[model samples]
Target: MSAPPVHDPPAAGVVRLPHTGLQVPDARLRVVRCRPHYVNRWEYRALLVRGEQRIGHIRGPLPDVAEPGPAGVAGGGPVVSFHPRGRAFTEAELEDFAAACRLDGQGLSSARVLTLLVDEYRIEQMVRGCARRGGVMARCCGEGWVHYIPLRAYPRSAGQCAAALAHLERASGVGGPWRIWDGQQWSPLSVGSGPDTSPGCA
Candidate 1:
């Protein structure tokens, strides 16, 4: 006889559900529910991930039927668009998902939600500061958008960001960005700062 299957624990700030479907055997699929950076009240996305790679995603208001799936989700919802590679979700799978994340309209805890809101506000403020000051490293949020991150907040190739410390150092005209201070004035950086290196002139 085979032993019962074991599942991995969910990551921090991420809620996950075990998938019991034949789509991908060995219980590899994980149904994750979390608040995205741009989510409305009670709105969240259900991401389907196989192992470490994300396979697909569906968005909608939780505790209610999600947006009609492209392949006609398990619910009576009709199909609007179709993708050749998309897989249809079975009724059982949908039911399990609903049961896992059952919640009322108010949504997650007020304290937790408030903390996330404050964090987002601070990030936006920093991005705006980058635009007003010089040293913006990149422009995001579609074309023509002024949203950016200053070189001081740029992440290293290893995905490390010492943004707060960098900000203080740069303000003192010591270190940070693609430039340095040589007692009298700031000068171009002497070496590449890994992935955060500034773009060269054309």
Candidate 2:
């Protein structure tokens, strides 16, 4: 019924298996397996420990409070877009938007970021640039201790990111009846969206 501890509880943020016994239905947005060969290899069950450290059984499921969270307007935080339209965002405003995702102190509870463009051409360009030049808006997502953007969301160069895999809690909009890719499919982010009235304030 319950899985025994393999090693001392992972250090904060290190991915670990869901508790065997007191499993909460929705406590964790996701549970993943980490490969010992990979860098983020903490996604598996605790490994077997040796010596006098046998007391390292997992205490119990993390309390509900341990859920990762996002700040500023639910999980939306602030969204950055490549759409060169109605409003232009200063560097500061863009960074602030990224900051909202980490307020909850959880690992990136939501890593699905919405990127919009003026048209298919620009969107394609962004995609191409990410491929040729390496990295994409996902990199711009932020590096705040893996909070602004979950390590999982980070696209390895070009169009390799599976943002949809992670839970998208909150989001903001900009550019065109811009499309929204909320871990599901591409749809309109807003029904009756309009351009921004102020500068750099998406």
Q: How far is candidate 1 from the true structure (C-alpha RMSD, Å)?
A: 16.5
Report model 2's TM-score to 2 decimal places.
0.15
**Model 2 over residues 133-154: C-alpha lDDT tens digits?**
4332221112232111122223
Look at candidate 1 and tell me the lDDT of residue 59: 42
Please identify model 1 stretches exceeding 4 Å from their true place.
1-24, 36-42, 64-202
Q: Which numbered prediction scores highest in lDDT against the true structure?
A: 1
lDDT of each: 0.33, 0.24
Model 2 sits at a Cα RMSD from the real structure of 21.3
- Can you give the TM-score per candidate against the true fold? 0.21, 0.15
lDDT of 2 at 129: 49
